[model samples]
Target: MTRVAVIARILPVLAILVWSLQGVSRAENALTLDLSDYELTFEEDFDRLDVSAWGPGTRWIAHTPWNGDFGDAAFADPRPGFPFTVKDGVLAIEARKDEGGKWASGLLASVDGAGRGFSQRYGYFEMRAKFPKGEGTWPAFWLIGLDRLTHTSEVDVVEHYGHFPGRYTASVHVWDRKTASKSSSVHHRVLVAPGSLYDDYNTFGAKIDADWIIFYFNRQEVWRQSTPEHHKQPMYLLVDLGVGAGWPTENTPDPSVMLVDYVKVWARED
Candidate 1:
């Protein structure tokens, strides 16, 4: 009976070991990629915002100067001919008085056909940033999916205008190809103060699970949306310091600043 007792104990231990190994194997099979271990996936300490590493994904397609543009005019202030500078580890997309006698300094995303590549399905996305505070400066940290070379599905994780202090906006855009227009569904949430985004750095993130996209400000959930049909495609990230669009037009003018510390992506560890 001593031998029988030993066998019973050994069988349970072996069975538990096998079960644990199976669990680990399933986790390994589910992981596609993980950016947490990568140190150089992002460029840092920029003395000047470089566009070389960026691809056909970076270009100026349309601006306030473009007619019939759906973007906000208050935020459309691209300095007519000059470009913004990134120096001393800070990116300053400035608005100054040019010889053209127009106050211009605006932000632009990766052009339709150039710049950063694209991501399709679900992943973890995040950005650390401090926005500018003047009456009309609008800043945004967001993402858009390049659907076979067209801007069809866009997601705005955070969009803040100077006029709306202590609050950030989130939205999703669905393009109507036939009508040449886009349908936007959006939500606005107030951020915690003292920790307000305008004065200091804060981290914003979104975890796009299989069927749910949850928005977080400074790591706290502020909003969530469920759309299983569209959450499976990869999407690229975008960070822009826009001036006077959306809700910034309602306030006064002051030289605002948008400071981005870093953007990071991550995945679940098995």
Candidate 2:
């Protein structure tokens, strides 16, 4: 996810909490909603890359619903094997440079501009992925509010930059379209051992409810903040292999690939 305005000294750093996962246990590989007091609502194991369907009633679109393509790469549409590929139940979102020196990448949204697809008002959303390592590689999993007429609410589950080896950010933003300003915003950084994220797959998740929005790394709580008022409505999902987040992409890995094992969401069973 990209920030709309330049975060100068004006935007206060709400929290800077760090949890080192040095010796964390990696038990319980299987994901289940029963123990969490929730029910499975949506899941995408990437059995296949369905590019033919890219609109309302479909599973995904190639770009953001608002057509905002951020970072150093253009979110390219699905092609033969350029930006997207599926093999053995894994989805690889690739970023590469073309002969013309233009960078193109892949992004997938759960809904289209017409506000049709899978979305939930509040739930626990998770993505298990292995991030690409190299300067200028930006991978993110985020959510945006469905109601885009007036204001917009955003929840960034995980935004990892390649330069920062074992650090990622999660944030919440409430932007008012009429005033073009963020009414509420908060940013937090989570840290672990350097280069640990690039070695293997890890899970990043967020739990959103009426009172708070909590972030989790490997299913462990890391940070939390009050849920914005505008975010109470249903929101859709987006995962992308971006290029640069206010950094240089000249030395970026030509074919940086982000492998996603799965994306799943569970709604409270109440």
Candidate 3:
């Protein structure tokens, strides 16, 4: 074969190879984080509300199993019917009033009232949820120490107050032995658009490591900070729709619902 003939034959093959490489590069760049860096540890789609590998009965307890309630609203027992339901592959936590006009909402904790369930030291946690929109309603996907909040090491991945619409709060707090009744915290009030959280589902994520805690919204990092030394223990998850953190729920509407699509956690593949 002539030299020119050989060159022409090889050139098209080289071009095709180059085009294929470029396509792969674009796909990697579009991903928020290389998921290959971690191993799946926990996940919940709420499709059946209880039928996942890291779930069903292995991960979440489905109920808070506690006594009293906190915040501006009353927390109802995380039971089968009233405030909690699984329908159309989604978990709905509804906030409503009873016949006497008293407020009630749902709260689910990974651990039971006796403080026993799944807990992780450090990992990446994420959730897809649609917030309930109405005055005085507060919906959140958060985590606390497996030992409970008395120690005060709580990581608020996404907390949406209905009064504010599209704004969500992400915060990390440590209140251990050294706190002396005080606390150290890093918090951010993230704003998107007015009532945006109600319009569609959004993914909220947090990567917790030894030195840092990074927060993400819609798979994009939004805020981060150095990890506090006091947060050195394992933590469990919580999802709830409350009437207020400390404010009154008198203005809250009777029928408010927060829809959850899935929750996932991954441990770094170190």
Give the C-alpha miss distance for residue 115 in model 3, angstroms.
3.5
Please report the candidate that would top TM-score against the real structure: 2
lDDT of each: 0.51, 0.81, 0.68
Q: Kindly list the per-residue Cα lDDT of model 1 for residues 107-188, writing each as its tens digit.
A: 4443334333434356667788777767666677666665533334556777765666756666655443333323234444
Q: What tens digits encode model 2's per-residue C-alpha lDDT throughout 187-209?
A: 77777777877899999888899
Top candidate by lDDT? 2
Please report how far candidate 3 places residue 48 from its true position, in Å: 1.7
* Clash counts for the predictions, in order: 25, 0, 1
- lDDT tens digits, residues 1-270, model 3? 001122234333211111111111111122365567899998788877541212335445544544445554566645567577888878998988888887787777776666666678888888899988788887888877655345557788887767777577787765443333354445577767787799999888888889988778787777776776656678788887877665467777788899999888898888
What's model 1's overall lDDT? 0.51
Per-prediction TM-score to the true structure, in the order listed = 0.66, 0.87, 0.79
- Which runs of model 1 end up more than 4 angstroms from their true locations? 1-48, 52-83, 101-103, 106-120, 148-151, 179-184, 246-254, 268-270
Better of 2 and 3 by TM-score: 2
The better-scoring model by TM-score among 1 and 2 is 2
